[model samples]
Target: MNNPHQNARMTPLGRAEMVRRIVEEQRPVAEAAAGFGISRRTARKWLARWRAEGAVGP
Candidate 1:
């Protein structure tokens, strides 16, 4: 079977870490975003989702 996350740049753990760095560590959105190799906008999207719905967002 083809694995969907095989070629993916980010995984579930990566997302959790990204959010953790931004929230728990209080890292700047831009800095954390860059560290994760994603754009600040994308980071904000996840941050917003994290704020709104948390890890189990739909």
Candidate 2:
């Protein structure tokens, strides 16, 4: 199969940016999600990762 997330809207770095937008830029979770073209829940998941691990990715 083609690489997973090859057609995805955002990459791992994008998720980090999303977390930055929420934490550093003070953007709302929904607004961050909308800006990144992802769902609020997905944004929250990344934000949660940032909270729990202070970083992005596995």
Candidate 3:
């Protein structure tokens, strides 16, 4: 079976970098997801994980 999260890559970006791109660079979640070849939901999940744990998520 194919795992949806697998498509998301779960690359675990650095907290500072993620924050800079989301907050300062103001890149849309959908754009980020497309760049990573994933879905917007995946991008939002990554953002949430970053906010909660400061990175280090799957």
Candidate 4:
């Protein structure tokens, strides 16, 4: 079977970077989420993780 996460196209590091761009560049959350092919809720969750813990994923 295909790896479901492969279709997601973003690694843990990539998720960090995406959040960084959204925060550092003042990019819109919705735009970044769309660009990363993830839901805005997911993006917001990651951003929250980053803000609270300074890291994302394992």
Query: What TM-score does each of the candidates earn?
Result: 0.79, 0.78, 0.60, 0.76
- Residue-level lDDT for 58 in candidate 1: 11
Instruction: Point to the candidate with the largest lDDT.
Output: 1
Task: For candidate 3, list the clashing residue pairs, or say none.
Answer: none
In the range 1-58, model 2's lDDT, one tens digit per residue, is 1233667777767777888888999999999899888899878877887788776441
**Candidate 2 colliding pairs:** none
lDDT of 1: 0.79
- lDDT for 56 in candidate 1 is 46
Per-residue lDDT of 26 in model 2: 99
Order of all candidates by TM-score, from best down to worst? Answer: 1, 2, 4, 3
lDDT of each: 0.79, 0.77, 0.59, 0.78
Residue pairs whose backbone atoms clash in candidate 4: none
**Residue 1 lDDT in candidate 3:** 11
Q: Ranking under lDDT, best-scoring first?
A: 1, 4, 2, 3
- The list of candidate 2 runs beyond 4 A from truth reads 1-7
Cα lDDT of model 1 by residue, 32-54, tens digit: 99998998998898788778887
Highest-TM-score candidate = 1
Candidate 1 error regions (>4 Å): 1-7
User: What TM-score should be assigned to candidate 2?
Assistant: 0.78
C-alpha lDDT (0 to 100) for residue 25 of candidate 3:
86
